[model samples]
Target: MFKTLSRKTVYQNRWMKLHEDIIERPGGIEGLFGVVEKPDFSAIIAVDNGHIHLVEQYRYPIGQRSLELPMGGWPEQPDADPLALARGELQEETGYVAEHIEQIGYHHVDNGGGTMGCNVFFATGLTFSGRNPDPEEADLEPMTLPLTEFERRIKDGEILDACTIACYGLAKLKGLV
Candidate 1:
């Protein structure tokens, strides 16, 4: 185990904060460590008929459009349940509400540094509703694709979000997708 010697705030921003630390490792080596603690998030894999619901958005930082499941973090509502967050995000991003929602799993997105984890949910019996997307989420558009086509997109690297992929992969492995 590594023991933290000292910790200092390296950066602080509205969305996320970072900490730098001096640590003594179990191997008796002293080194610097960086940690980023962001709020936990939730994502939904909503399936209706034989199609999977996804959102297409232009990610400014990546300068490309990404196809990902409905996902969001509620930093201000940290105490809120992840299932509620999942339901809210699904409706906000995709305008779909599911009668059945099951917790698939959680994933550490960047275990090396970031403390961001995403709770994955499997949503079924979906019903459509009007979307109330956030202004910051202007580029998002909800789309449904056939399960086969979605899997093809993933295999073709068209779907690159790790959390989304991990969730679907686990769902498939467990024969839940």
Candidate 2:
């Protein structure tokens, strides 16, 4: 195991913190590691009948728009309840609220580089109300598609968000889809 000798914040913002660490390997060799510290997030698979709701938004970092599951973290409330976050994200992004929601899985975003984990939720019995998106998500678009079409989009490399793909796969294996 690598032991952290010292760590310093290289940068910090409301949403994330970047840390540079000095680590000692088992053989007594010292090396540097960079880690991104972020609040835990939630991803929602909002399903109704045979369709799934997803959101498309422009990801500035990637310089493109992405179609993915409704997911987000409350940076100001890092320790917020995962279930609540999932439900809120689904409604905020898709304008649909679920009558039932449950956690299907949990996983780290990037074990090698980040301290962010995601709670995957399976939601059903949805009701359409209206969206209340954050200002940053002003361009977000919501859509509902058949599960098979979603799979096809992933297979075609059109859906590239790791969290969305992993969460859906886990939900599928657990018969939540």
Candidate 3:
């Protein structure tokens, strides 16, 4: 088994922290590892009458806007419940409140580099309510399209968000879609 000989925080901010660790493997081999520590998040696949709800927002890191499934985490409340987070994100980003929301799967975001995972949710029976996005999501735009078109966009390279694709795949595989 690998062992951590020493660890230190390399960087930190309100959303995440980076940690550097010196580790030892079997046979005395040693190396350094860098890990990003972030709060777990939720991804919601909101479906209504053969259509899917998506949010388009400017992703600062990519320097462009992306169309993705409603998803987010409450960094300030790191210990928030996943169900509540999923419900909140759905309404906050897409302005669609789900009459039914249930967790379908859970998986790591980036097992090699980040200590973060997501709870994938399947939401249906939606009702429209005006969005109340956070300041960071000031540029958020919500849209709904047929499920077949959503899949086509993914194939056409228009929807590039990993979490969105993965969550949709999981829900589909589980026959929730």
Candidate 4:
């Protein structure tokens, strides 16, 4: 077991923080662990008329366009419900709201570096509207693709976002797709 000795904040921003912790490992070795963090939240895998709703955005860190599911973090409003967050993100990122939203599961994105878990949802029966994307997310735009094309992109390694891919895969395995 790893026992924490001390924890100190190393960085802080609007969305998340970084912490450095001194810990004693199971083998009796004492070391430091750097952690990046945010409040846990949910993402939605929405499908409508045989097409999946996705978002295309330029990730500045990677300097490339990426495709991903509708996702968001509500750290500042931690008390807000996960279901509401899911619906809000679906609308904000995809400009679509689902008439049926079902909780699928939760995923730990990076257990080694963070405790941030994303709640996964399967949504259907969508209605489109104008998007109200956050200013910080100005580079994002919603796109729709057929299921076969979406799967092909995954197989080709074009869709690189792990959380989005994992959630969709799980949904398919569970016959929700």
Candidate 5:
């Protein structure tokens, strides 16, 4: 097993940190591992009457307004329950209160470099709730497409967000939504 000898923070912010670890490899060789430490986020598949709610927003890093599931986390509160985060994101991004929010599964944000991951939830029985998006999501637009269309978009490479696609796939495979 890889054993950590020491860890040093290389960079840090409200959302995440980069750390470098001095390690002993399984075969006893010494090496280093660079890791991004981030709090877990949550994604919600909000479904109602054969449709799914989606939010379109500009993602700064990619410089594109992309359609994706409602997702977010309380970065400053990493210990907070992911289920609560999912419910809040569903409400904040879509203005839809879910009468039932069930966690479907979890997925890593990026297995190669980051320890961050997300919990996926299947939300049902949505009711109108006033939008109160986070400042970062001020331009978010909430809409519903048929669930079949959402699947088509995924198969066509239209939905590029990894977490959104992974979480939705899990919900479908697990028969949660």
Candidate 6:
């Protein structure tokens, strides 16, 4: 296993911290590694009947709006409950609350370069009220599509978010979907 010889925080913000590390490789050679440290997030798959709710919003870093499952994290509250985050994000982004939320699985975001993982939840029996999006997510639009259509979108490359794909796949694999 590679050993961390030294690590230094190069930058930090509310959302993430960037670190530079010197590592002793398996062959005993020294090398540098850059990592982004961030708190985990939760992704929710809200399904009611045959429909699944999703959020579409402009992802600034990617310079385009993308479709994804309701997801968010509280970097300020890293130890926050995963189910709470999942529930809140679903209602905040999609204006839907699930009568039941089941944690399907967890996945690392970028094991090679980031210290972040996400908890995935399978939600059923949704009820829509109204959205409570944050200012940054003011433009988010939510849509409910047939579960089969949602899966087709993923297969057709219309849904490109890795977390969303991974979460939904895990749920489906576990026979929750």
Q: Model-by-model lDDT, in order?
A: 0.90, 0.94, 0.94, 0.91, 0.89, 0.91
TM agreement with the true structure for every prediction: 0.96, 0.98, 0.98, 0.95, 0.94, 0.96
Residue range 36-61, candidate 2, lDDT tens digits: 99999999988998999999999999
Q: In terms of TM-score, how similar is model 2 to the real structure?
A: 0.98
Residues 1-177 of candidate 3 have per-residue lDDT tens digits of 999999999899999999999999999999999999999999999999999999999998999999999899998899999999999999899888999999899999999999999999999999999799999889999999999999999999999999999999998899877
- Per-residue lDDT for 7-62 in model 6, tens only? 99999988999999999999999999999999999999888888889999999999
User: What residue runs in model 5 are displaced by over 4 Å at the alpha carbon?
Assistant: none
Q: Which residue ranges in model 2 land beyond 4 Å of their true spot?
A: none
lDDT of 5 by residue, 1-177 (tens): 889999999999999899999999888999988999988888899999999999999999999989999988897788889888888888888999999988878888888889988888899999997889888777999989998899999999999988888888788788866
RMSD of 6: 1.0
- Residues 1-177 of candidate 4 have per-residue lDDT tens digits of 889999999999877899999999999999999998888878999998889999999988888999999898776796578899999999988989899998999989999999788999999999988799999899897899999999999999999999989999899999987
lDDT of candidate 2? 0.94
How does candidate 5 fare on TM-score? 0.94
Tell me the lDDT of candidate 1. Answer: 0.90
Candidate with the larger lDDT of 2 and 6: 2
| Backbone clash count for every predicted candidate, in the order shown | 0, 0, 0, 0, 0, 0
Screening candidate 1 with a backbone cut-off below 3 angstroms (N, C-alpha, C), the clashing residue pairs are none
The digit string of per-residue lDDT tens for model 1 on 93-154 reads 99988999999888899999988888989999998888989889998999999999999999
Residues forming the 10-long window of minimal summed lDDT in candidate 1: 71-80
Question: In model 4, how many backbone clashes occur?
Answer: 0
TM-score of 6: 0.96
